[model samples]
Target: MVMKVLFAGTPEVALPSLELLAGDREHFEVVSVLTRPDAPSGRGRRLMPSPVKEAALRLGLPVLESDPSDPSFPDVVKATGARYAAVVAYGRILRQPVLDALEGGWYNLHFSLLPQWRGAAPVQRSIWSGDTVTGATVFRLTKGMDEGPILSQSTVEIGPDENAGQLLDRLAQDGSRLLAASLEAVGEGRARLVPQSPGAYEVARKITGEDAHIRFDVPAFAADRQIRACTPEPGAWCLLHAEGGRDDTGLVLHVLRARPLPADDRAAPRDLPAGRLARTKRQVWVGTKSNPLELLEVKPAGKKAMKAADWARGARLADDAWCG
Candidate 1:
């Protein structure tokens, strides 16, 4: 007998799990999908369906476009007749009657391991902190923030050069497979959920523009981590500093891509002081406490993204161009 599954998600990160369940004919049937309603998007702020909603429509799955805060939410969930729900980045909390609405249970696929970075934006937080290890968790959905018992977990290495978007894409893919297997285990009545250890969890707060601000006073490695974590959203940026001037003047330059300081450059500040920018014919670099960080792509205010070296050339900066 195929189990009827209700899918709940809101962003592109959740698409993999939705697609995986929908494609499986032998085990689970995705009877319906619950996603956030159309919201303003893009530069024009026109109404647009969420990525999950768009994909759900493409998959021919019924979509419940409602928030948990709605008075009719529990009734709507009950109406679907899908006792079990698979949630991934649903962007809302499931409350009492709503949790009770699904008799079987609600299982969430979180982007971080339980008791570690348990909140929204786990992937971004992990990178910002220079955590070399992180993973995904499939767990029961409780009223608490990812405090439910763990159904399963899959550990993954944080690639040295990978950004938040890149790491998230990888986790979503890998987590989909893990979720499917866990669901299969549940179906076979062989699933065992383990309770997480108590009271040692870390918080993963959402990234703000200030959180993404590049600080040249930090070491090159730390700066690299923060930059990669904020990439592609609320982008990591630094203020343009005129020679011998402070960065308080609001001249911002968004850093789209950065490379690790090469071994040869790691110990050498060269002619550049901390927060200073300079470039050779082949590369652009920004000085840090430890070394100069290689700058690959950047976008000055009101400008399109371009190679950092090109921007430097066009600006015709002095040898000690400042970018604090």
Candidate 2:
């Protein structure tokens, strides 16, 4: 008794769950995959199929690309004869009508635990806020954002040095296993639904360019979290001040990897202004309010990423040079 499932998702994170459903032929049949339309990507802006679309095509599944605003969207879903819809990072919110069209309703696999990080950018927001533990949740779909009753969840520990990209990759794999089990329970009419408790809720808003700037006025740990959160996308960047007024305008450099120097290891004067730069024989440090951060890797505006020490040598920064 294989249940027919309508899969909806986009992006690389969604591929694992999509593939898992497609491979579970005994218990589930992926009738069709719904994803966002092809859009321009990369520097050349060439139209590209989403990661889910590519995977769905490779599995010999039909794909539908449409927004919720389309008048015929509900009809398209109804025609699939899919009783259950499993969504992950679908990149679009579903209207009530669309959810009603499905015979068994919709289920969404969110990257964060329910009632926390309930909006977009959950993985990035969790790391940005320095949370030590985060996990995935599969819940029934409703009009409210991630407010539906929980169907299944699995927790994962966040590594102290993990960035959003790495954490997401790991969670995606864990979530696929959880999603498969939940789908099986649903098909057998044995899944439990738990309502979220009343309490303070945090929203995981989308990240913007403004959030990518490294703020040295905060504690070293805070700055480190910001850099980790923005790594690999909308990268954390800082302006470098050149000595001798060679470039008073400053140069933009992306911070790829960094660590906050412990108080005992900090050698600079405590009163040094934030955003100042200092260097040892083999390492480069940036002053913050509480301590300095050791820049391990960086990428100049037009160059590939390299060791921060290498960039420091190329710029010939004086011992007293500063960056903002």
Candidate 3:
């Protein structure tokens, strides 16, 4: 018996699960795809369809667009006669009525294990906090944000140097398989629900522009985590002064890739201030409280990303020049 499922998602991270559910016709049938309306994108500000919408249209599935907050959304979903709804990065909070409309309820493929990182921007928050391990969760959707009973989950180790974008790509692929297995169990009436322990989880809130600036007063490793978490999105940036010590007139350089230097490698002269810029023949290093960070890649404002060594050579930075 094939269970009809309504799919809701937007963005590239949700693509794998959407495709998986649509292709598994024997066990589940995608009744319709609901995504946000087209929005402006790129330098031209042209309206563009979401990745999920594009994928659904390519597969000949009906697509619906509307704000989930609209009171009539439950009716709209109920009209589809979908036995279940699967949501992955849908970017909206569903109301109680909407939750009740689907006969089998909604199953969400969250990027982090709930009740941890339950809000928006889970992948980014996990990396920002220097978590050693993170995973995906398939859970029953409720009124509260990510406060749902778990259907299934799969864990993955967080690589030391992994950034938010790289980690999300891996989790998206792994999550699709977990979602599929959970769906099968639900369909066969053999699925188990595990309630999350109260007061045992941390929240993963959205990232803001203020969070992207690198602070040199903190430990080098913390600064490294900030750089990786902010990369590929609101990039981590610092102001760089010329060798002549004109702090008032400096260039803002976005740090795209960086790593912390070991304790021995960070030993510097007592007079060297934090945010000081130093360079070896092949690499660019910046001072922090505990140690210095080696800049592997960087982008000057309004310029393309390039190797830090290349940028340093082009700028003709003096040995004593500093950045903050």
Candidate 4:
């Protein structure tokens, strides 16, 4: 018999899994979908529905909007009589009543391995912490955050300079397929549960405005890592000396792309000051505590993104102008 599936999710990260399940109408019936309530967004502050709601509407499926703690949530979910529920980036934790309704119980699609980066912001935290690897986890939900027992797991390599946004996009695509496979395994009663290893785990704290500030005095490689971790959300930037001598104010610029200096890149200064700009015909390099970052693209405040070298041409960045 086809399984009745209830999907709870919000945001683009959840769309792929929803789409995958929705597409398999013969094997899986998406009885209901739960998404966050419409909220104001963009410069105009227009109300916008969550991505999952948008997709559910496209498929002509039932959609509900409410917080997880709402009194009506369990009744609404129980109305569907779904055997299983798939939760991905739902933005709210599941309470016990909703958990007990599903015969097959609820499963989550988390971006990192279980017991690691369990809370929100896993991808961002992994990149910021300089981890060389991260992956996706499928687990049965319990009450203890992401501490659930895993049904399946897959490993993904962290690219050299990938930020949270880029990594999320990649994982979404991978998770689209992985989640479907996992659910299929569980349905066939062939899935195996694995216990996570102890002590290598870390939590991804939510990103804040303070985390976006670029500290030029830090090592170039470390600074680059920060840029990669926060990009496209809270962009990584620093204060530089602008023309007309405005007392060296903060010049926020979004880092679009960056590359690390090679071990033999002897041209950089040993004690190069933070926020100092170096340029060549092809690229613009910025000084950190050690080495330099070759900035391929940047977006200065109130301007479109441009090549760092192009920005350097109009703005003369003095070598002595270091970040204070």
TM-score of each: 0.94, 0.95, 0.94, 0.92
lDDT, candidate 3, 1-324, per-residue tens: 798999999999999999998998999999999999999999999999999999999999999897878988899998887989999998988889989999898999999978889888888889989898989999999988898899998899989999888999999999999998998899889999999879966778777777887898888899999988887777788888867486477888899999987777644333345788877668888878887788899999899999998998888887778777
lDDT of each: 0.87, 0.89, 0.88, 0.80
- The true-versus-predicted C-alpha distance at residue 119 of model 1, in Å, is 0.4
Error of 1 at 225 (Å): 0.4
Ranking by lDDT: 2, 3, 1, 4
For each of the candidates, give the backbone clash count.
0, 0, 0, 0
Off by over 4 Å in 2: 244-247, 266-271
Better of 1 and 4 by lDDT: 1
Query: What shift in Å separates residue 117 of candidate 2 from its native position after superposition?
Result: 1.0
TM-score of 1: 0.94
lDDT of 3 at 6: 94
lDDT of 2: 0.89
lDDT leader = 2
Q: Which candidate should be chosen as best, given TM-score against the real structure?
A: 2
Clash count in backbone of candidate 3:
0
Go through the candidates in order and give the C-alpha RMSD of each one to the true structure: 1.9, 1.7, 1.9, 2.2
Candidate 2: 10-residue stretch with minimal lDDT: 264-273
Candidate 3: deviation at residue 264, Å? 2.4
Indicate the TM-score of model 2: 0.95
